[model samples]
Target: MALVKEGDTITIDAHARSLHLHISDEKLAHRRANCQPLPPRYIRGVLVKYTKLVSSSSLSALTDFNLF
Candidate 1:
């Protein structure tokens, strides 16, 4: 998938998928700080889930994690 944009949402293959968006941890933290309705507990869960998913994916180059 080719990344077309960099922000709260990354557009990949926009020609076929327009609603494809991935919320980053920084964005989630901002939402939690501003009290954007997403619960704090859920925010923690999302962080954990994101970490697990990324660590297991081929996107390891994007991060310096030693995740195996």
Candidate 2:
């Protein structure tokens, strides 16, 4: 599958159980936080989920994520 997009509900494995997270951020904050010692990466068989297209037509004031 391709990379996750906004409004896509993802269930990722967090140690013992699967943790559900919504990927609305453009670059995924937890994965891109510079203050954190380690950054998140795409792990084979670990990041298992599909992307769901978000309906932007309904949202009138949704702020875009800063990817830079």
* Best-matching candidate per lDDT: 1
Task: Report the C-alpha lDDT of model 2 over 4-65, residue by residue, as the tens digit.
Answer: 44667888786867666666564566456544443445434434221122224565323443
Error of 2 at 55 (Å): 39
Candidate 2 Cα deviation (angstroms), residue 36: 27
lDDT of 1 by residue, 7-67 (tens): 4455568678655548676755665566634345544677766654454456543454554
| RMSD, every candidate, angstroms | 11.3, 16.6
Whole-model Cα lDDT per candidate? Answer: 0.54, 0.49
Q: In model 2, which regions exceed 4 Å deviation?
A: 16-68
By how many angstroms RMSD does model 2 differ from the true structure? 16.6
Off by over 4 Å in 1: 1-21, 36-68
